[model samples]
Target: MSPKRPIKPGASNTSPDTPFNLPDVGPPALHRLPLNIAPQGEGRIPVDHLRTPVQSPPSHHAPLEIVDLPAETHITSVVVHAPIEHFFLAPNQLSRLPAPNALSGIRELGTQKHFVDLQEGGTVLLGIDSENHFRARLNSDSRPSGPRLERVEGTLTWRVKPSDESVGGSDSRLTLKRLRNPDDGPQEVVAPKRSSTSTGDGWSDPWKKWDSPPQQSSIDGIEVDGTRFLLLPRGTDPDHPIVYIKNPEHRVYDFDYMERILGTDLMQQPRGAIRVPPANQWEVDPNLPFQYPLKQYIATYFPLLSDTSLNKVARHQFGLANDGDMATDVGLTRLRQTFNDWKRGNSTPHPPLADPLLMLPTLATSISGSGLSRTLELPTLTPEGSLQRLDFDLTRQEWDYFKTTHSGADLKRLMASILNRQGYDVFTPTPSHYSPALVFRRKNHSFVFFISLHRVSKGRTIHQPLNSGPDAADARLNTQVGYPALQEMLQAHAENRLVWLKGGSQVHNSQSDSIFIVRDNDSRLGTLANL
Candidate 1:
């Protein structure tokens, strides 16, 4: 029980997982091209340079059939169709989209919020990327709205090349020798080949190979800048903490220079260093109970949130090289199971309430000084208006309509009423497109007020045959009127526009009566005393 020692300034304990902004050195260039397609023998063309053609191509005969076209006849071709995809936005999930900032690659188009285009081109991109949210319009043609979101049009190509170290290739370094425009942000710097030359403020080096095992600080190896040095903490090696530097920048702190400056033994340490495991460490057996304690187990095995080694380990041990695909449903399931096992928990929770703050009930204990509650308990609704779980399904259209129409104050009042009458309390957060429900109890009876929002569709329409049955026409008409009204009422009530569905008779006699239509200005609305 001693005070934790503070890391001395200039001391080397930098974790390997530190975010390294390495410069791009690979020859893969980002070029902006026109969306127009080129015919045989035509090279790629820039979009902005392209212009409308003066004349049309001859459709009668092929130029290939004849050796050459008549010199006297001027060949003219008009752009038949433009490659519209470049203009169209690419569809990607809202969650995957980076935060709206400089690094996100999405830039605002105008004054409108949530409307943006990709920086590469005029691709109209979605605001947020949660689940496959990118939709780009390649051309001027607009896509029809539907439940499934639309994406922008663009060809996103990614190539994964073998790392130079993995392939036994020399570390091909590219020194950003000189910058034509150093002050210009993100200006291209051309470094022809590998060598040590000073650039502006720091150095640039290519990312390391894929499979290169992290080296220990004490081990000897070839140096980047040909300088010699050794790792610190002297003979017995008692105090020097091993640090890992993945994706090191050679120009800023050239590996060799660091060794020379710090002293050959300790200065030239590996970018990533781990304490060499005990000479005869026990092998971990999956079947046997783990001997390593939980705290040590997590640090050594589970990798902390800030550990960069996790990236390398994931790539090697689990084939999880890419962060993008790690959160998939299958991956999430595996992660959940691992977390459960690590915590020694027997049960796993479901997707939890869509919006916990908004959906939970309000009680005297629920509210705080800041008007926030930590938990909400709701009664389970029955399927047949009996004792079942209360939930609702909604179509995209209905959801949109409700969000546009309602307010939070209206929703709170409605919840207050339901809780008093049916023994249920509701906690609605901010307005959203999701459907909300109420679950409450009465004397020896539990009821769930389930509200579902759906689009008007043929299948949902009640069938009414001509002269087939007397009640058929009335029933169909009644349903047609009641369903839409019901949707309208629910939305209004949810939004706080209306408080209660009132009728003179306790039980509704007419369709309108049975369904409490909103009376906006009824001064005689029930107080808590009535319930």
Candidate 2:
């Protein structure tokens, strides 16, 4: 049977007709036996003279065997240092990086995108082999005018599985973990990359090649010659199978512009510097679609999903590293005192995917490390590509409100003004024909936002589309002639066009594009640019 489509308001599926099928009790004759009648009245037939025999319990010859749990399994681990920006922005998908050749001397299976749950910090790592546990630290020295570098530690027993389309082949997963932060020591700076040539040209913001390699390395290191991008000694990750190169690039260069170099801290996890496998060994590409194995896995094959599921896989909770389920104190704890901090909520432990509210604090912390807040401009995707935040003004929420207000030319101009602030060339066509369609053009992107205002109930604070009861048609429409004709007119330029039916209730529609609007809290879009 075909599944039902979305039901319109006031529609009913329950029918007034009686059901054709009914219970069967073999007519009035089987209703009751003679002496089997209820105590209230005697309808008298004795019915069966003999009763069925009861089944006896099993004898000693046929005893039941007790079931028991099998032997315990140990979790193996390995740490990955990832920068914070790439974890959150732009073509924000984790690359399907293959597993290390050998983790702590054990040959383990590898999966693609080992770091999808790397939401907050680089402190997490792969699970450990029961035989060998890996422990390492990146202890940085206290510099003048700098706060004590709180030792960033690794998370424990991370088991990450990828979706079918994940770069690491279908249904493959990785188990990883990082070292603990309990160790105390003076700044322990490991050796730098063998050559500064790694960062001489266009900077390798997130990942860089250190010793230029014998030019190649592989997951198995077998017949795969010229396998692409030899691994860099991912800084001071003690649990790293090999720390051939100390730092990917100069520590000073990492915060140059996060996402562009501005995302995570140089050393630790949970904002830890990620291991970027550049196309070659010497330099890393700071942009997406950079190279093989580490390129972004855009979800093109999947059908348009409801707004909620847009980020379901990339941001859903995998087995968290801090659930504290394991008995042994092998990860980030000493004295064997492990509690489910996430459940108790004593403190905010790292969640598999960082929510926007949680992201506020971390981003602010990263910004503090970045002296570039001097311009107060936010990093736009590429090199020096940034939003001029000093004078430009527009929180995405306000832009949405003004776009749907429908207040003649002033409303149109205000929408245009918001786009202009972000350096877009905004234009309002005559008649504002797209239910007041506004054209926004910037760089290579040209977008026509077909905005429709959502309706709200009289006393309720909630917003909605296509109001129900007594006033359904009273709700404003998408446009006078509606979307079909409008869509046909702009079909040639369909790629750049968009639907802005407000985020309130309109976002629930499966076809509406899901966008991340920076909330108004942080000095209001002046800090977090939507560009």
- Model 2 per-residue lDDT tens digits across residues 238-334: 4532212222222221211211211122111111112223322222212221111000110211112222332232122211221222211122121
Where is model 2 more than 4 Å wrong at Cα? 1-264, 267-408, 429-435, 446-448, 453-531
How does each model score on TM-score?
0.18, 0.23
> Tens-digit lDDT track for model 1 on 1-531?
101111111222233454321111111111112222333211222212111111233223211112333344322221122222222322222223334444443444454333333322223433322344443322222331111123233423211111122212333432322222334356343433433322211100111221123453334322322222222212122332332322222222332233232221121122323332333211111110111111222232222211222222222211121123222223222332333333332232321111111122222113234433221222222222211112222245533544454543333334435334322333332233322222222222112222212221212121111233444533432342234434443454455533322111112223111111111112122211122
- Model 2, residue 183: C-alpha shift (Å): 16
The deviation in Å at residue 66 for candidate 1 is 47
Cα error, candidate 2, residue 443 (Å)? 3.0
